[model samples]
Structures are given as structure tokens and as C-alpha cells.
Target: MSWHKHLDTSWFRSDYAAAAMPHDENGCVTGNYWLAWPPYITDDKSDPGSLDKILRRRFKTLEAAMAHVDKAWPLGEETT
Candidate 1:
């Protein structure tokens, strides 16, 4: 069993911006998943590029990506 075996390639958003594994013409999960933020990256009005630095900008697994996202914005922590 693998991550792709249970998921499809679709760009969706949650507390973060968008993230998904890219797919090939044959509809296969071709590579690692990518993460992205809105054009205006200053979510906390701190540093616009800070979040990207936290993300490492890539992931080989969805769980890893999610773990990083959690690190980026921890529970009970308020950005606003």
C-alpha cells in the first residue's frame, strides 16, 4: 500500500494554501507532492517568505508535508 494508491491528484486548500502530488498524462502520481501559499505570503504580517522556509518547499509523502504544516502553524498558536 502507498499514498498514491489511496489518493488522487487534486489541488486543495486548508489552513495552508494548496498542495498536491503532480500527475502524468496517464494520471499517475509521478513525483513528490508540492506546497504553495497565496501570492501575498504575509499571513501573519511578519515575514512573507518565512512560511516557505518552514515548509522546506517539498515532500515525498503527504504525512511528512502535513507534519511540517503543523510545525508551521502549531495548534493553539494564533497567527492573527
Candidate 2:
């Protein structure tokens, strides 16, 4: 005989695995599942004259990152 089981596994996993990283020892991020990192710069200068392009992104939550990805297009949208 064969048996099947229905499970609610959605709670166990996420599309972005990195979102599950352990929070700080203080448990701040654990209380609120949002991790904030320092704003990264491409170069040493605050406002560089170099033509080389630089890209930076900040996400308040995983959903925000996914939303940005979904809105991104080949030609780039007016807002992301």
C-alpha cells in the first residue's frame, strides 16, 4: 500500500536562504527580521568624477528585495 502526507512546509524554508542567518547576540534582528548594513561605496571619494558606474541597494526586508527584483526589467524601470 502507498501513503501520502499533506504538510505545511512553507514555514520551514524561504526563497532567499541568506535571510535565515543568525542575528546579533543581542537578538535585535531576531526580534525584527530586518538586517541593516553600512552603506557601501564603490570608491574612496564621496562624489567621484570617474565614469565607472557604481550600484548600491538597501532592502528593509526580504519582501522588499523580491519586489525590487520583480520590478526590474531589461531596460530598467523609472522606479525600483
Off by over 4 Å in 2: 1-55, 74-80
lDDT of 1 by residue, 1-80 (tens): 11222245544334333446666787787766655333235545445335655255677666665455455555345554
For all predictions, the C-alpha RMSD in Å is 6.7, 12.3
Candidate 1: list runs displaced more than 4 Å.
1-7, 10-19, 22-31, 36-40, 43-56
Candidate with best lDDT: 1
- Candidate 2 residue lDDT tens string, 1-80: 11112221111112121122224565433433322211222344443211131123445565553334334321122311
Clashes of 1: 0
Error of 1 at 13 (Å): 7.7
Question: Per-prediction TM-score, please?
Answer: 0.42, 0.25
Say what the RMSD of model 2 is.
12.3
Give each model's whole-structure lDDT: 0.49, 0.28
